[model samples]
Target: MTLGRTSTVPLADLVRRPELGLVVLAGADRLDRPIRWAHVSELRDPVPYLLGGELLLTAGVNFPEDVDGYVRGLVAAGVQALGFGVTPVYDEVPASLVDACVRQGLPLVALPATTPFLAVSQAVGVALAAAEHAELRWLSEAQAALTRAALRPNPLPTLVTALADLSDWWCALLDDAVVAKAGIEEIDPVVVHMARRLRAVSGRRSGSTEVGSWHVVGYPVAAARVLVVGAARPFSVADRAVIAVALALLALADRSDGRSVTKMLLGDDPHEGYRVVRGQRKARGDAEIDLGTGLVDADGDRMRAIVTTVPDVVAAQTAGWLLAVSSPVGVGDLPSADREAARMLERAVAAGRPVTVDDGVSGLVDPEAAARFAATVLAPLATRPELVETLRIWLACNGNWDRTAAELGVHRNSVRHRIGVVARELGVDLADTQRRMELWFALRWSD
Candidate 1:
């Protein structure tokens, strides 16, 4: 088997070996093409077995009468050169075959009577093996360099630069948009478009497509994160191995970076106080501003910020984000704030605006207690999702029958009936404002 394109030996190198006793009779200028292997075949039609870049040898034992057709077939099969042995068959290279090879631009090699085809094959084999060994060594060196870079203070930029250097191509780490790039001033629009397309299609770990003269390959590093490479040609097996190493390193760096951010956010540093925000759109600001404001995840869907003063709900609403804000708390209480922010996020999503929590629900005591109370109170309607949803909407509308019906896309009488069933099943009076208040808290906390 032949090593891939990256580790191929040129046909001229093989021809230059004096021990092979091979002479190029045609296509001298085309000797630079890569030679994958030296294949021996005496059959009249050996094109079916060829995989391109082979130096085909023959003794003329089964040489076809149509010399032009034979040469054409070999060219079509991507045979790098034709070696005619002059011992057991025609004693000399035929003029017809030489003319045909010259016409087809296929290099013709004359194997002398004393030189065996096996010698040339062995030389080519040894050369290919050496090339493959060198390629592997290069890949190993590149992997080591990338690993070292990954351990540096800023690993992402280092990894990107190392990958581009190793591959001799531009590389980019696409976190939502272009987060880190190297070997190129600006990312091509086609690469950006392909990155977005790959992100949208889940389970597709890797893909390749053409962009202008460049070949673009993309690998999904994480959810909403992609690694893109642009090169003049397709990547070789060795190139792909290096890319896989870089991807793994990048993933490790991301996990470690996230943990570091989390630790800093939750540390007991006296100046540490932050809020976590989740939204559907990417945050807009300067790079330094973004870094100072918060750590935005690669997906651009979430951020955690260190701020002395919390942002107002009105600012979030005006920006068209379903924002959730947490009350100022100590590092130890940040986890509780996260949960409170999550609940507020849910409420904001439902209300199509922003929600802020100064201190979580006062009447519910705690989430566990509220859950237990909801189980006891709403167990009767547990199996009826429609009734539970109606109850929730009805409570959210403050017992307004007509508004609840409008929201549920049902008649006011249907809302009234579901509410009546809910009250009777739990044996509670719906008209009692105190009971309504308790039910509302239960619904909100349980959800």
Candidate 2:
């Protein structure tokens, strides 16, 4: 069973045990309250000697003069429930005590003549210990999960999501700004303010608080940054320990050197699929794409990068900067991926939109042999840019004279003349369907 952090045993756990034979006499509705511990007390006023949430057991040997005031004091001390031993106190629960308990909404349990007070205490102690052990096991699993999450390509989001799942609550990160989160859309403003305040301090600071319905913890993991995690209930000892492990992991994550991380991501685990991205810096922006220089290599007006998968956009697009992504490849073949991305970039520039390489006739044959075939067929028009472009546009238009002419921004007669010249120069028949298809494949590879 999936168990969360628990420090106390619920009163209902003991009441439902058939062996205990404990009967709820008054305030039965309050049995769900948490019991910190079970204590046997007979003094008239035990409030000063007691802590909250204890099952205060009594035989009423030294009964108080004022029963109503006594019950009120117990309630004020936050007693989980009052247990009265029947024979030792009276034949049954005293009417005065029961009436006072019912009036003040204090749960009163009748300990039968058979069950000793020590047995009830022992049951509670065992339950509390079992809960503690289960929580420790849960915490150990949580720490391992966080470590695995830190190994992901996008660790911040992955780690945040893991923490949320572990605590059954929401988590967010603040890096001079609220950067990432999971399991929630909005956090309490008070919690956020506290986190931001924690960020301004130094010396590995951390804090927690009760805000409205939430219990929030702020971990100042990095300089000017904080990781804020919260749940509806108070955090237990084990829960706080798990949070501490997360903070240390995040600190290491912040200390990650970009260059080394990029290197680690690239060559290691190469057999698994990886993609290369090519971006042509056509426009300038305040933000430049920086997945790190090792991952992204800049050459002239273009840059190439390797990633685990494609993203919607590479950081900031910088406006009109074209991007083309290559098909997946491994480490040994990674160098060739740059060339593939370059070809895709040319295609993107031609189509005026982003382009990604996909399986076509190119996949049917060895790429080197296909390139040789394209080079041989289009060798005649290698020096002739006009014929190559005209053929490309004409074929794209499905041999429509007017459409190709409009797209090429040239007259139909000029387009026709250029096609005839291309046919003659390449020594191919334009009317043959097979010939056109072969030439189309060749031209695509040439581009």
Candidate 3:
């Protein structure tokens, strides 16, 4: 197990500090071990007072008879290194202590008489705080980079690049094979097999192993999709956190990331009929949502997808979304189905609930009476042909200013202005769901 946090300075850090004048005399190769703290202990047996990972400093005030036994005890107590101070008790580090440390593989450092043990302790504390601060700053910046990558046009590839850039490690997204990768040109066969093995096993979300000096790890993010990353060194806690964030974002945007609607529709069989769904977020902006395993394309408040099964309207509403689902149609009819979903979304938004295109309420009512009532309610919009057409198109688009504008080949500001005019002319607050529902019905019956 590791001794301390990544923020804790290693034994080597103390020796490199010019002010400390500390020199490594034994176990030089093991200086990378982290020092949790530094303390002066002149007792012959300081192991009993240790809680592990300490750089125990002493001036040989009370030398142990058995130096080998003392070094072994410190090792058992998890003392990372021993620092000898040249003072009244000794002009230099004892040859016996140095030999015992080398034989036991315990790190040893010699402190000059000019440098007090207290200064070494203070320096260790200051270095630890600085390292911790640097790690936190790095974590925050790395998370921000991932967020920005997620918003890109091709999020999956961009995310892979971001992970590679931040970690300086090879990152790849794997399905049956590598879907996207960075930091390496070709993937090792062993890495691919490990990813597949992880997918085959049940309840195995993540696993890691060492291969030929490379530390490789894999995590299952979605159905049949795995994110694999490799580096020369093992991953730290912060590194894992950044990868988790990327995996979660990738999972939510899986089928649709850099993929097209056609691929989603033909996922299983080309002959299979599919439904087009549109959803409007109750509260807009970024939030995680499950849109099913289909070709999903989400742009802020509006989301579109081609799904095999009909969506659960109640579930969508419960999840804070107003959903609209179209009737199942073949691949050739997807275009028409999307328009149907768009129109359904308009009603769902106005009614402040979920709506299905197949829910035809017009036939239930008397057509003549409904038409008469519709004409009376819509008479104000009918006098101007543009307003009548605009109202119809606008209602078919769920009051989305941008979409309404795009359909009418007008600017979004123009669409907003026209909607304001209709609201004022009818003397009703468009913000009211009941008013919008009434207007939707009037437009529906008029058509």
- On TM-score, the leading prediction is 2
lDDT of 2 at 437: 91
Give the residue spans of candidate 1 off by over 4 A. Answer: 1-7, 88-92, 261-447
**Residue 429, candidate 1: how far off, in angstroms?**
99
Question: How displaced is residue 19 in candidate 1, in Å?
Answer: 1.8
The residue-by-residue lDDT of candidate 1 on 148-182, one tens digit each, is 67755568887999888875689999967777899
The candidate, 1 or 3, that scores higher on lDDT is 3
Candidate 2 lDDT, 206-324, residue by residue in tens: 88888778888888876577889888878777777888888887777666747455654664565567778887766654224544323556666677787766645434344546777
* lDDT (10s digit) by residue, model 3, range 322-419: 88888879878999989888877776775677777556754234446667888898778777778877877888888888899999999989888888
Arranged by TM-score with the best first, the candidates are 2, 1, 3
lDDT winner among the candidates? 3
Spell out the clash pairs found in candidate 1: none
Worst 10-residue stretch by lDDT in candidate 2? 285-294
lDDT of 2 at 340: 83
Give the alpha-carbon lDDT of every model. 0.77, 0.79, 0.81
Candidate 2 residue 205 C-alpha distance from true site, Å? 2.2
